[model samples]
Target: MFKKLFLLILLLGLFNHTSHAQKRIGIYSLSTISSKSGHLFGLDSDYNGLFRAIPAYCVDYFSNNADFITIDRKNFQLIENEREIQKSESFMDGYVVGQGKSEGVDLICQSVFDVDTYSLIIKILDVKAEKVLCSSDKKMDKNLFGIKDLKQQVTGMLLEISSKCFENEIPVVRVLETKGKKARKVLIAAGSNLRLRSGYKIEIYELVNEKIGNKTISRKNTISSGEILKVEDENFSVLEIYEGNEKLLELLNNNTPLFCKPTTN
Candidate 1:
């Protein structure tokens, strides 16, 4: 009787733990062909069946994990119906966030397939923070039969994506040179390799020292701002002073150790 009672108690404990530990996740339909074509194509019955099949695979992958609770098609469809009733715009990010909130999900994951490199890109967003927690790309190559194996290919990829959760944001790039020496334009340390876009506003910060416990800590002082005028190559970008103020130009002339972060509005 004591052994049976102990077993019952253990079962109850496990049930309670699993009930409270789940992190609700919403997986959107996979989008294919990023670099080859700027246009985004969604899942359909006639084409790219593999992309449509990915969401279910994701659900199965996380089913055993006590920390995850993926929103299935039924719940996701309900959210879509409600969105239509509310006449809300269905922009991908906005839609995902709305669905996540409606379903009380903690995170939303988006899958994308790039045709050029045959790579899969996964992006996970923290629903409450309204920010991307992580993004990773994995190449899906064909097997010996010269055919892609969705399950085998994406299993390892999913493992990689899962491991990157809660990672730090992309590191800040630095300013390498000022264009034309004393000119308002500058050269920076990011380019196509980092997937940087042109016309992006950036914040320039200078390294400053602060004393703490007999140790000097480095801090950033916002010195100026600029916009990426051109993407030069894999290693460099061209920036021009966005503010065009003499003070900012003078700061550029001062030539202090500087770093830049992409400006967010």
Candidate 2:
């Protein structure tokens, strides 16, 4: 009886863990075409190469930097090959979603690059939801120096779109250490990787769970706030507390469960 009970408990724990696992993202092959000159046949090799680099860079960026998401590279290759065959024709939304769902990915990242106007449109689709979560349409100067310059622009655009698409998955910045008599300065466990920059405001919060009449309500209560002083590295940053400094210090000293999120203001 005890062995059976232990196995049941272990099974439940595994189920819970699986339920909260990060979403898997698959990047499709970037489609390139000329808006004015008509199709792939009219595009030069340089333009095609530059456009193809977008999806490759996205796959690398998300795989290395996005800790809160998972990338299915094996399936991405399959989808990429299929899309490449259909590059000359327009692919329907239903087909894309179906492919993503069949591959077991939760989200799909797809883009279309117009070679003539140098316009790029990126879209993030939620496979299960069968809808676009967010999208960005950016135009670039055709006179850009070379492929490197175009790559830099594409990376910036992708970062912005990614931030919007996975805003909720942005990892919480934790107070790693503190300084100052009143703890006016703090070191957090996040930096440029979180897209944090000097002068960006961060709101500190403590998650609270309350039980009321057999139901549990969870919410984040803002306990303090700060402005970024410097991004020390990819894994750390310094923040100068501007609000509720004393309370923040108290929480820090007590080692309370605190987390911070970057604010738009």
Candidate 3:
């Protein structure tokens, strides 16, 4: 019927809107400390190659894996061109903010590699807020000695960055129903549409609020952990709790405001 068709169109529109609502991120070309120092000494060929490859790797990874983020490739190229013109790998914070705003991206990722200290520092900036959202500093592991080991170290650091930036994208579902007092299985309000898969771990938690002076702080207190047992449909999945079942059952019995999110691990 026309009514059903209209409803279907509306749902599609909403889904498209939600998909586009994801944050757009631009990654600048990797910078090096030696370049910032303006010294004649330059990084070795291997290090240079590694630095050049990192941004591409990041682009490919996000393009393939992230459903909740859009990569701003056009602006990324522009930024790289500007860097090449400047004949330097380093960019100032002001430049980063200006470029980020001009590109109209929600977030910007910048990395600085120290050739001397073997440290890779990554920073994610919020363009509208004009501030850093998160950052990570990683030093080459002592155990990792060769170029191959260095590549692995850098890859691990990049993965950490990805994890931090996309953390909010993890699907959150509400516990809809519980079997019984000793319930090990529960139904949730999310499934395949959220990219949830069987065996993916989930953590159940409740927000706890505590007052300190005139301020109230809220944090998640994990009550239980589970893994997806089945994806029944696009909007529902079943989980089997393997940890803290008693606490989870008590919370469900009392109808607590508990939420579940897929674990990054």
Candidate 4:
């Protein structure tokens, strides 16, 4: 009986250890661009509001996944205050990464909004490496014309970058085409170039707007998973459906906000 009790305690400790291992991500205040001039502008009251709201948006998007821990807003504000004292030039990615590391975060992220072009750009920096991990530029669709809509779109884009930051092993692949009439198979953007091979399973997620608490959060929901059937040239591969049904095929065909995450067998 004592042995069983000790084993239970050991298992609980292991769970707590693993749970705390999630990467910590820090978000800096957003920078903006002049729509007509296409040049960066100084941060104003408008930019400050956007920056303050980003943390909440980020936390909402990543809530379901325990793989990320966002830096506290007050701590992030303190970093911003320190940056002002240093009075360094703007867009200094290295400084941002350094500050993030000092604050015990593994990654740092920033967003730029182009008011004129109505585009959102998000950049993720590896704090330890002090280099860009990934950057994404997304334009607001007609459906996202409203301010609320635009913010949601930007949140989704940022979440994508954040999710990829922790997944060092999994390369993101795009769906190129759905083969056959049933669309149970898909051609992906990764192949030998990404060192992919057959018999590897991949999870696919669809971006959706979910109402969580009082906010409308944009997040990725796992819709289907598949296995690599063949790795063609350097840039393409075919995947067969190991899980999911016709609904997954339809989502892929519709050009939904979908991304593939590869897994090791």
Error of 3 at 217 (Å): 0.7
Model 4, runs deviating above 4 Å: 34-40, 45-52, 74-91, 142-148, 166-265
Off by over 4 Å in 3: 1-24, 27-69, 74-95, 109-124, 134-180, 232-235
Error of 2 at 38 (Å): 7.1
Q: Against the true structure, whose TM-score is highest?
A: 3
Residue 244 of model 3: what lDDT?
83
- Candidate 4 residue pairs in backbone clash: 35-116
Cα displacement (Å) at residue 230, model 3: 2.5
Predicted structure 2, TM vs. truth: 0.52
What TM-score would every model get versus the actual structure? 0.48, 0.52, 0.53, 0.53
Candidate order, lDDT descending: 2, 3, 4, 1
Question: What's the C-alpha lDDT at position 54 in model 4?
Answer: 55
For 217-259, candidate 4 gives per-residue lDDT tens digits of 8676777788888888877888887666466667755756566
lDDT (Cα, tens digit) per residue for candidate 3, span 70-89: 46442244333344344443
C-alpha displacement of 214 in model 4, angstroms? 49
lDDT of 3 at 99: 80
Better of 2 and 4 by TM-score: 4
The clash tally of candidate 4 reads 1
